[model samples]
Target chain A: MANVSNETRPLSPHLQVYRLPLNAKLSILHRITGVALAFAAILIVWYFLALATGPEYFETASAVLTSWFGILVFTLSTVALWLHFANGVRHLVWDTGSHLGQKASNRSAMIGLAFMVVMTIITLWIAIGG
Target chain B: MRFLTDRKRVEGLGSAKQGTGHFWEQRLSAIALLFLVPLFVLPFAYNLGDGYEEVRAAYAHPVNAVIAIAFFVTVSLHFFQGVQVVIEDYVHGRLGMILIIAMRLLSTLFALIGAYAVIRISLGA
Candidate 1:
């Protein structure tokens, strides 16, 4: 590809220039939750590796999960879980050719946010001694 | 000097068009995330007793193991695609681009390895 001169080209809607609309915010949240889940991959590896080595190893793994840091990570993972799921459902609805209009788009975004909050609360409840 | 410089430039895409692959993969991962998220969330509600053997057995169950593996794989792939698009849009400088690429590659590899390990342990290997 040829290098184009920035000066000659008309201004484009770059990240800063682009107004963050409902759809845009939801899109960014999806990416953020994705990154969060990527970090949770470490827990998955730890669990599996512990299981492979048997009961003693598994206890060591479980103990870490019960600690403060483990609980924090677990809580974060739950939030990521709900956020991704709710946003994903929104994406699926959009895929079905619905919710493209302004009113419906805002509604979907609100619904997604509400669902994520409710789900996260329920998840944490279950995680912490519920 | 673009197309005139190379015959490869004449081809629109590579040998295979990958639009469908990417689309379906994204959807499949999304669906997996939907179910896996709930299953993972549910397990944390009830405290697993403080017994090593009990906890081990709970995880050793083929179903639990399978679901965990599925969650690991789907979550990782979803993250991989999401981060790639973000990096492509936001990364501009040479150093930034390199960092983005490195991040994506490592994230994918880590996800893949974690998923593989989960499957092996879940299957009782």
Candidate 2:
């Protein structure tokens, strides 16, 4: 009541003050990855347009994507993709009414994190070698 | 005929069903992408860096073409939904409304261009 009484009273801590839990961390990671992938929408669309354009344009797009910077971005995007995927699965599971507790949430986050790392590693290996 | 102030109307604007509709869309596309991504990405990665004709031949298969189109549409829709949530959370006022519409247009563009590309290659046009 006292806190509500004064408009300028000290407020609850925000992002700066709170040390977020593992689940919270992974939850935000999901949003970040989503945004990253949203941007990659342009790249994927570009790939298609380039292919449809002609051989020369396709080659140019291919070269740009296979370049070092492109590879770096792709790697990060792929990591984000898997991160989002794994956490998304966690969300699906949670929606089913299981894994709803604090401890369980953290454990699930760890599992999802592990899954993301393994999948990302294998995919990157294939992407690089193939 | 009921005339209500803009503030009164919008302040309680939600019909309550909108949230469920949004959730359903998000989940449905998510489930679709769960399958479509693997279907689309595997062949795409496999064909990456291939010659134009070779890639075109791969996409010429109806299955590949269909998957490409479905992937594009679902991805853009899901993206539009996700970015709407993002923008709503981070932005406010008329600017937020404008950005939401922009995201809609952007998603539509992504779907259109992607389908066009796939269709052209698929038909050998």
Task: Please tell me which predicted candidate would have the highest DockQ against the true structure.
Answer: 2
- Model 1: pairs clashing at backbone N, Cα or C within 3 Å: A126-B45
lDDT of 2 by residue, A14-95 (tens): 9788898788788888898998897666887898899898889998888877888777778888788888988888888887
lDDT of model 2 at position B71: 96
lDDT by residue (tens digit), candidate 2, B85-110: 99999999999999999999989999
Worst 10 residues of 1 chain B by lDDT: B10-19
Off by over 4 Å in 2: A1-14, B1-19
Query: Evaluated on chain B only, what are the TM-scores of all the candidate structures, in order?
Result: 0.65, 0.86
Q: Write the per-residue lDDT of candidate 1 for residues A21-127, one digit (tens) a residue.
A: 87888787788777777666677577657767777887888788777878787778777777778888988888889888999988988988899899888767665
Single-chain TM-score of chain A, each candidate: 0.78, 0.86
Global lDDT of each model?
0.71, 0.85
Give the distance in Å from residue B8's predicted Cα in candidate 1 to where it truly belongs: 18
